[model samples]
Target chain A: MRAVVWIAEGSWQACVDQARAILPPDTAVTLLHVAPGDVEALAEGARRGLFGRHPPPPPPHGSIREISDAEAGRLLATARERLGRECETMARRGRVEREVIAACAQADADVLVLARDGERKLGPPSLGHHPRFVVDHAPCTVVLAWAQAPPAVETIPPPPRHRP
Target chain B: MSEVVALLALALALAASVARVRFAPDWAVAVAGALVLLAVGAIGLTGVGHALTRFGPTVGFLAALLVLGDGCRRAGLFDALASVMASFSHGSARRLLAIVFAVAAATTAVLSLDATVVLLTPIVFATASRLQLGSRAPMYACTHLANTASLLLPVSNLTNLLAFQAARLPFARFAALMALPWLTGLAIEWLVLRLAFRAELDVAAPQDAQADADAERRPLPRFALALLALTLAGFVASSTLGVAPVWVAVIAAAAITIGVRPRPAELVAAAQPAFLAFVLALAVIVAAAGAHGLSSAVDALLPHGDGLLALLAVAGVAAALANLANNLPATLIILPLVSASGPGPVLAMLVGVNIGPNLTYVGSLATLLWRRIVHAHDETVDIAEFTRLGALTVLPALVACTAAVWLATQVT
Candidate 1:
């Protein structure tokens, strides 16, 4: 079986750990990391807001894109180390959800693994908007893992009282 | 009647574009509004020329300052400064917060708020993260001070540039007049930020051997520092020399760019023709609007004198307008009416527009940009939390700064 595991910031460890524990030992896994383009967009927005169409000189340290790419690589490397297996690693950029979906399709995987990245309480929001979209729209079987220990059932708020 | 309707429609469209349009640049939206006005004959070519002539120096100075700021960033000025700030922090979140306040305030005062927002914010965020300090206190300090600390100099904000031109105050005199209000605003901002982010500020800094080594190796950008000092001196001397400060800014910007040896693209971006064009177009649109009934409406609502109550009222109105419209357009709309009243009301209005944007996301373009930079660094600013902080800080800063301006006017 082919599996694609989505590795996102903060939640990659959970997804990778779950993949290791659950997936068959022989499953072909591709660890996918998407560097959200919003960072570059934000940097560009600042440039445009101040200078208009003109692009500022590259920063002495590194450009935002470079830093973001390096960060994505570092995250994927760390995840790979924790997974303790030989697997293909992929780094893509753009919208996080869309990129994850595309990586899954391109990998031709039978199952997709990801972690809930938002609210920990029991509800629709437990899967953040991005992960929720990926889970709802992915073209393969979806395995959902929690980024952290699940919250108590009582954490959910009570329903509103009805008016007579 | 048709002309007034067209102008009103144009105003609404411009506001929406500024607030919501993400596909196109702000300068493009503003240019589109200017074209519509011209197409409708709300303003003649001669009137356009006049507006350009009036605002040309402000736009020129803004572009030059942006270029200079960009050069300094390229030379690692802000990075070095952040390193120094981190070193001074000595592994204490509280000390880091204090250092952030001082650095942000001084940066806004000297280099302009755009520099603080666009440049200093990211460095501060990185520094905080590297030191394992809570990023909230230092990050908020950068953004908040970008607005409040801007009161110290004429070149501190684009709005200040407009107000300075209309008020016709000498550079030194302008700084002197705003000095008290500027300091008062920073003090209030510091107090409120400390209270608001007490949990974040109370953390103990972790010992990071790698970060300490990195901070030690970051070299200070002495050339950029000396150039900035020289530029500031030129701004003060220009008033006595009977030359516009824009000349000083241009020379300084050119010097820095040449020293940094930017590529062609960098040079063009530094010139920022699109933003300069936006400013010129905005000038025409504002002038046209002022001519066709908008000014009369604003005039009727304006307080009559420069008394304490009157100055406060004027500032309150300007703040409301700034939040309603963005601060740049708000400055254009309020400036002519306030300028007629004298430097006192103009300066008071400055206090409102500068400080007021802290209240809402829509209050200033700089605040909006600041939000983007924070998000870019993977940090989230909850809207409720932001508004809560803004509500706690803006009014106190506004009232105190406005009163300071009033007192300064009385004394000076």
Candidate 2:
């Protein structure tokens, strides 16, 4: 099986581990992390400048982008260890919804696994703006993983392959 | 009755500001509120004009600082400072904690808290990864110092600038009064971080002298430093000459821009007109609240004495309110109430709002930004652990700093 699993800053490990158990032993997986040049961070940069007589210079282009890529690399490394295989990792900077869809098309995977409700660091499930976009517009079968603890591997269903 | 209606509008505006609604950004809500006030005759065009005339220069000074800070960042000044900080680690995590605290404090005081968050944080993490030290200690130091150290200078934090402008205190007067409080806050923060992260910092480290040497080899930011120095000196001089600090900040920002040659779009993007609009709108809301009895409510809460106990009480009230609505709005609401009581309460309120945010991520905009940066580094900050650490650290710092400021007020 060929699968593309989307990950974010605060996703659950169960989402990865459970999906791995259901896939064929030799399945090829692609881990995609898209860091949309966070608007919140940029607004913060602007807020700092708000007090000054002159406008602040734009956040050094790629300052947050570089940080995002490095963080994505670290996250992918962890996912790779759990999957017990070498999976392709792709990190891009742009709108999250657009990038996720583009990546799905480019990877041409049989299915895409994602946390249906966005994973927040320490809060209840945050049904973020991105998940709805991913679900509504994905290029392939979409698996909406929940944040619950890992279910028994035997009870897990086979990876769905309903391409949109 | 108009005041009552205005208060309701303001409350709705603030609620929408922080809510995660998809309709618009927080600034838009603020703008809408201000417009509503004008439309309802709660505050007239004359009142809006008055707010602008009063806050206009401070707003201009703030914009200029953002420009200079951004230009310096682009010039690689902050990175150079970070590399220099990492070099002092000497391969020991304990020593690195000391150096990180110092660097973070200086950056927050000079470049502003936002700069420390957006600029220096990544450097601290990168330095940790290179040294193979646990990143948690440094990360906490960065966020903690960003708030506490900002007590020192008007340029250090937005709240300080707002209060300074409101009080119309001299630049020197502001610094002199805050010096003790700032030092006390830093000391408490440092000690707390050390105790909380002792287990993490106790690890032995192999020195990476070669990386330090290479980092040191990069070109120095001599021009940026000169500009910064000149800017600080200009602020002092402007105050003495009775010139607004905005002039100094604008000239310095312009000079840096000339040298850095950043695109105009980059400059405008960093200006954050939305936030400026928010500030203006918030001022209008608070003004309307004053008409409705909010100021009298605050006045009634004021302690009668100028003694240490009174200072502490005022600080406590400000802190509580700050945590409720985030420091920026809280400061805006409280500023009008406290303005008539004199500089002592105003400065004390500044201490409260500034240090108060250390208690929770929602207490200040800087803290919220810190959380975002932490996640970008692939680290999770459990809210419970954060609150636990904060309870141990922030409460003490708040008390010590407020007391120090009160003492300074007495002596000076």
Candidate 3:
């Protein structure tokens, strides 16, 4: 009977704020984040600089340091501030969508709820196309809940799957 | 004199084909080689007596085919048919069956069966590759169906027209014979192919997971819509007016060539090798009649109430020979022969040949085109593999049709 809420990648505060708004009182929420690392996708790339084009423009530099008790505690703080003391939060880290799917299966969760800045919505990396895949392979139904309010319209009023 | 020359030339052409099979090249392949030389000799020895135009039925047949096939292609009329087929197939065998059925059925209805196969072959190959649906089912099915379906309509097949003319049967009666073969052959084909490739059913779907478009050409299959319409209209008119099938060809070709910047050899191309073969057969048969005892003998044999079985046997043998040794010529050769066999049996035989070649790769011109299309896409399919799948379907269908024809003979 577990319902898992995933805090997808974005402004930690904005996503936390939305997650808090959706969860019921006393619900346990898992705070997830993609740990920063040089995930050289191609082991070959790491072993031998796999590209001739000079190293990709350096990833932006700034204060990405831990903000609270747990490294992801900063996101949880934001969620708690928005939702109040009713929900218990714990931080977990991995690839956003992949981790969410695996975690949902492990938690025996009924649904995987993720918050999207109406714009960060190309969809959870591989998990979005995975519904049909899951339908094909998963033993249970997957409920994909996304924040529909389109990002550009400021008012945060009506909802939609995509802008158009 | 012209008759003598024509007969002589035909004999030489036959000899030349034989030499090619034995030694080939110089004697067999040259333009002045045995075949054409004989044809030329036939023309020169006597010449067209009082003839203003040398190509009568030939030219007319060509023109009509081009006009009709071109016009429909222009309209995007058959463009949608491909997608419709892709949707119908449920799995490997069914999908392949659908592809073959679509090509065969379409060939029977609109374009000449060979042209129909040519037109649809590429589409079939593309669909197979795009879907990554393996098993030689589609290729064999397309070829078999093309050959089989060609017998359904008069305008769709030269053999049908000759039989129709020879028999002097009404439209309704001719149509009645058509129904049984087309449906039965298709069913038998499906069943055969299913059994042939039953082992391949669990074959995998493409992992790429994308909609694929193989070899679709535009401005070609597109702009020919007008020609297609004219061609069909010609067929409909032929039935109504009782004009020779050649008249339909003349009108169709003229409609295409009139003051337009026609694509170079485009009409000829679309009228197709298969269609041209039929035309050539017609010319050859006409030439052979006087010398070959084709007329009186054929007359004596046909229009018989008691000789139905003999007549059917002749027509059936002629069609099978046509399928084996070039269907077009076989058709032409047999047309006069069957005039004696009577039209009912003759028409039934044409129907049989139309569908019979589904048994082998080289059985029909349409099949060769379908094979070419599949290969052109870098897709590999061997004849043995094709025949294997076909045997599963074609033999049964042929047997069932044989019974149907026998029963039909009794009914009449």
For model 1, the stretches where C-alpha displacement exceeds 4 angstroms are A1-164, B5-9, B12-16, B19-25, B209-216, B362-381
Query: What DockQ results do all the predictions give, each relative to the true complex?
Result: 0.08, 0.04, 0.01
Worst 10 residues of 3 chain B by lDDT: B25-34
C-alpha positional error of residue B182 in candidate 2 after TM-score superposition, expressed in Å? 0.2
What fnat does each of the candidate structures reach?
0.09, 0.02, 0.00
Number of the top-ranking candidate, with TM-score as the measure: 1
Better structure of 2 and 3 per lDDT: 2
Q: Let me know the DockQ for model 1.
A: 0.08
After superposition, the stretches of candidate 2 with alpha carbons farther than 4 Å from their true spots are A1-164, B20-22, B205-217, B364-381
lDDT of 3 by residue, A114-140 (tens): 533222334333233223333344333
Tens digit of per-residue lDDT, candidate 2, span A24-98:
768788888775543223323323322221223334433434545565677677667767777898877566778
Candidate 1 structure quality by residue, lDDT tens digits, B252-362: 999998899989887778777876887788788888888888888888888889999999999898988777666777789999998988778998999988888877533
Best by DockQ: 1
Docking class of 1: incorrect
Query: Which digits, one per residue and each the tens of the lDDT, describe model 2 over residues B1-412?
Result: 6787778866766665554356766677777877888888888888888887777777777778777878888899877876676667766678888898988898899888878776777777666645545456787788778888999999998888889989888888898999999999988888888877654565434333326434564565999999898888888788778888878888998999999998888887666566677777777777777767877787688685567888888888888877666777678778877777777888888888888877764444444554466467632223555567668877888788889988899899
Give residue B283's lDDT in candidate 2 (0 to 100): 78
